[model samples]
Target: MEKIAAIIGGGVIGGGWAARFALMGWQVRVFDPDPEAERKIGEVMANAERALPMLYESPMPKRGEITFHDTIAEAVVGATYVQESVPERLEIKQKVYAELQKHVAENAVLASSTSGFKPSELQEGAARPQQILVAHPFNPVYLLPLAEVVPGQASLEVIEKASETLRDIGMYPLHIKAEIDAHVADRLLEAVWREALWLIKDGICTTEELDDAIRYGFGLRWAQMGLFETYRIAGGEAGMKHFMAQFGPALKWPWTKLMDVPEFNNDLVDLIAGQSDDQSGHMSIRELERLRDNNLVAMMRALKGQEAAAGKLIRDHDARLRGPLADEVPLVTVRRTVPVDWVDVNGHMNEGRYGQVFSDASEELMAHVGADRAYIDAGNSYFTAETNIKYLDETLVGEEFFVETRVALGEGKKLRLLHEMKRASDGAVLSSCDQFLLHVSLETRKSCPPLPDVLAAVEALADKHAG
Candidate 1:
């Protein structure tokens, strides 16, 4: 059965939540009064469609339906999850929650996308307050993996379920044991933001320089290793304790205005905004979003290989989502829409990536017949001896396609495979590959026959294909 996610606002965060849920195969109902909600949400989805899939090799679930509802009741009617992304005002949020109880099921998890508002504050004066928890997601929710799950007067069950649900959909849910003012990541962000404001207010550094300090400095390490862990490595073999001990005195240093506020006067505001403009004002907002998404995709892909931090979430979930399969028909081994990150300077799927696609399909075929990870671990695996790829048509970003693979031959020590990469919209062959592999014993590092069971499975698939 298809799942339904009710989104109660259509602004950036709400729209982001919608995109995240919808892309994860949950039919999403969005309720908002803004006339421009669809256009704005569409823009967010466009960016998401290009970026999210690049993080995984396996096929994503089929995209679910998105409907803009006229009312909150209409939206939450059969929703399994109701996410409120309205403005941060308490009264406004409570009113929506009050109306929500009448339509949404008691079992449905109610989540708020409020960045700063604690779950307690959000649930205050609201009906069925225990159901409302803060599932605060970062901006560009589809691309970013972190979703802070903060419970109010809710059950641990709710928190666990919410966390698991978010994890299943490629998010890293950080559970807050105590309901603080701001959730974990945001609290750290606030400290940094406060100091940055003071710096700009005092003309200590321009907005660009401050940004460079982050992006060009510890930001890269912090992306995967995080603060204390990076510092632990800095401490050498002494570890986190030694690092903390060495730097503990700096906590009281008067270096940062972390607790102080810069008055939001017109002069400071103008200086910050003007400097920000001079730094990145040339690019439009959409262009900037694309740029950000591209950088994030590249960085995340690098991390995925290392199974580090958020990339590890993608890696783990992808493993659970896939397993060995045996198929006869040119099996649809790869089904995915092209990601913008796949595009090259010529504005199409880069030629090298086509080779990657073919390689992935061949790997999938290898797995299908039990010649997978365990087989490789057992010191016997297929080594590609030859491959021929022919690109028939130009493939572009966001274009849905599938690779239908067939085992042409499955002899004792060798196998031959053919993969037809076709566009999903129309059965047009985008590319084709013929791959020949020689099974080898890892111990001997020479040509050898696959194990009996793997050999049987391969021959079975080849026989089925031939039939």
Candidate 2:
């Protein structure tokens, strides 16, 4: 049975939720009175379709259907999950919940995307308060992973299920034990916002300068290590405790006016808006979104190499999505879309990426022949001795491609293989590689013979491919 997710609002956040669910192979039902909801959601989906799949080495699941409904009942009828992304008004949300509770499944996770309201506040006057929880996510919800899940009185089973569902769609569901107004991230953001406003109003820095301070410096660090971890590195040999002790005195300094509220006057708005316009107002919102998405994809892909933070989540999800190697003579391996990061200034895949793809193909071949991770961990593994690659044609970003590997020779410590990469759409040969590898003992770091079982499996594969 196909999984179904109902989105109660089709604004930016709701459309993002729809895109994420649909892209992850969940049929989406959206309820929104806005006549432009379909067009808005369609734009979000287009951006999602281009960006999300580039984060993985494997193809994403076939996109599920997205249907817009006029009534809440129609949207939530068979949905196992319902995400509420309506207006922030408490009365409006409560009214929607009342109508939703009447039609949605008893077990459906009715989650709100409210950044300010606590789950307890959202649950007020609901027929089933236990069914509602706070699952607040960041902007560009399809790309970013964090989802703050605050369960006020929701059932434990419901929370677990919601977390699992979020994980399935590549989101990190941060469980907040105590329901607070504006859980975790937003609170930290509010502090920064307050300080930034003060800085702008006091004529210290323009909006562009404040943004530059973040993007050019600490923002990069925060992307991977986050606040405490990044600060711990500043402690030198002593770590977080020492760092905290050293900087703890600075907390009393009047450097920041976080407690002060800026007057919500038009002048302040004009100041910020005018400066922001001067900064990056030349590009359309869609253009800026695409630019942001591309930058995020590049950064995340770099992090994936180190298997750190959001990159680790992506790596784990990719492992789950990866299928077993197909049983064929020339083994099917390295099937993936050419990611945006793979393309160089020439507007084609960089030459180095070809080596990585062929290397992946060889790794798949290694795993297929019994010399898997376990075998490698047992002080034995293959090391590339030689490679000869012939670039036949240029491959562009977002082009789907696959490689076929054939074991030319597999005897004792020697393994020779051939790889051909072809575009999936037309089956045009893009590149070919001839590779030679040798089994090595990890302890000695020297060439050695493989284990009997591994040697036997490799020999069999080599023979099969020889024909």
Candidate 3:
């Protein structure tokens, strides 16, 4: 059965949550009072259109449709999961839960996206009290995979089921041992903010300087090793215990105000905003968010490719994995974009470009034929017989084109392929080629039939999409 999730609210956070679930292949039903929800969600989905597919090395699962509902009851009726991202007021949450209680099925898991409230408070008026829990996610939920699971006085079985569902949708859910206002992450963040404010009040480093200190220095390490792990490694022959022993004494230093809350005075607010304005300078919030996301995707993918232990574990465990092939057909998996080396003086993709394109297509086809580099070195090779190319559009340097190939004809010793090239940005068809290939025994350098299994696999794919 197709999985369905109902989201209550359509603000930025709700829309992001919707996109995250939808991209992971869950049909989303969203109920929001705002009449402009559809438009707002459309924008959010468009952003995901570019971002989600680029997050992995393999193609992602097909995205599910998003349906808008006028009433909470309509949204919750058949949904297997319900995510309530309503306003923060207690009354509003209670009322939403009351309405949700009457409609959601007994088996459906109910989650509130409240950042501050404990689950007990949100579930106070919930009819199906045990099913309601906190599934608080970080901002830009589509990009960040972390979600804190705060269960009320609910059955352990229900929380386990909810955790499993969250995993299926590609999230890492950390269950809180006991619920508290703001939970674990926010409490850490609050302490950092309080110290940051004190710094600004005391006229220390400017906001941009503070940001640079983190991003350029420790922020890079935080992505792969995290705070404690990085420190553990820094402890030399000793471990976390020794490191803590060495650094614990410094905790008492007046370097930071860990316990004190900054007064929200006029001068402090203005000072913070002024520093923020200086730090941001020209880039708008949307621009900064995009910059952050793009960098995160690139960095994370790079670390994953290196098989860094932490990255590898995260990729293996945190379920909703997606890659390049998810968004479009990967004709070739080149390491980098077409560079100046591949361009002609006319500033267009050079004649050598077609060869590069053909080579990539050939490799992918070989990957299908069991004649890849390793196979070739092991005495199997695929040689091109003839290639007929028709360039339909001019491609410039740095433009990315993915080719899709179909085995037009395949017999005992010869395979015919039809390839179409498309521009990644506009999905414009740029060129096409029809080619014939001969499998050869590399040591003898003569034509041969592909291995029985290879032939069968190729024939199966060719038969299915012989364009």
Candidate 4:
């Protein structure tokens, strides 16, 4: 059965939701009164189609269909999930909900993208209020995993179902127990935003300078370890308590005008807007978004190597996406899309990435023959002795490719693999790798015969591929 998702507004956030759900194999129905809604959402989808798959080594689910409808009722007809991204005004949201309830299924999970409004506030004077909840997501929803889920009046079943749906589409749902204005992340952001405004107003720092201070400093730390963990590290050998004792008193110092409000006058707006324009006015919004996406992909991919933070989420999702290898003559060892970050200045997949693909294919083959992670951990494993790679064709970013491997030799203490990488769409051979490896005993760090089971499995594969 195909999952269906209804998006009530086709703005940036809504379009992102649509793209994410669709990319995750959910049929998306969209309704927005804007005449250019389709074009806007189309542009968002274009960016998403290119960027989202880069975060994973496995190929993404086949993209589901996206359709625009004239009315909310049409959009929600068969939807199991409805995401409302209309304007922030409470009255407007209430009206949309009222109309949506008329057509939406009783069991459907209705979520709002409002940043400030509590689920309790949105549920007032609504039909089946228990079905509604706040599922606030960050911008570029296709990439970011965080979705602050505020259950409010919603039932436990509904909340569970909503969380399951979010995780199914690769989102991390942080359940907020109590309904509060602006939720958790934004509340913290508000403090920083308030201080930033004051800084600009008081001539302490220009917008660019303030941004530079963050991007070149704490922003990098925050991306991985976040606030308290980073601060704990700052404490040195004593840990968090020592750091808190030293810096806690500074909170009382009049270093920030956080409680003070910068007047929302035209002069203030001009001052901030002029500085921002001077900083990044040269590039169009789409260009900026692409640049941001590229940077995020690079950073997150780095995190993936470390298996921390967002990278862990990505790795887990990749594991879920990966299926068992099928029984074939030349075992299909690797099937994945070339990520954006894999491409170098040459505008094609880098030579280094080809090495990675072959190495991964080799790992897959090793796993198949019972010499997997556990086998390696047990002090018995195959170590690559030598490899020769021939790059026969150009491979570009977003290209779907698979590697077929054959066991050229599998005997006492020696294993050789012949791998051919081919483009999925055309079956064109992109590259080939001939790898020679030796079974080694980790304790002695010398070539050794594999354990009985592993040796038998490898020999069997070699015999099968011998034809």
Task: State the lDDT of candidate 4 residue by residue for 225-340, as single tens digits.
Answer: 99999999999999999999999999999998878889989999999999999999999999999999888888988998899998999889888987777879899999887888
Ranking by lDDT: 2, 4, 1, 3
lDDT of each: 0.86, 0.94, 0.77, 0.93
Off by over 4 Å in 2: none
Which pairs of residues have clashing backbones in candidate 2? Answer: none
**lDDT score of residue 427 within candidate 4:** 100
Off by over 4 Å in 4: none
Candidate 3 CA-lDDT value? 0.77
TM-score of candidate 4 relative to the true fold? 0.95
For every candidate in turn, the CA RMSD to the true structure comes to 1.9, 1.7, 6.0, 1.7
Each prediction's TM-score versus the true structure: 0.95, 0.96, 0.77, 0.95
What is the lDDT for 208 in model 1? 97
What tens digits encode model 3's per-residue C-alpha lDDT throughout 217-282?
Answer: 987888777788999988889888899999999988888876787789998888888878877868
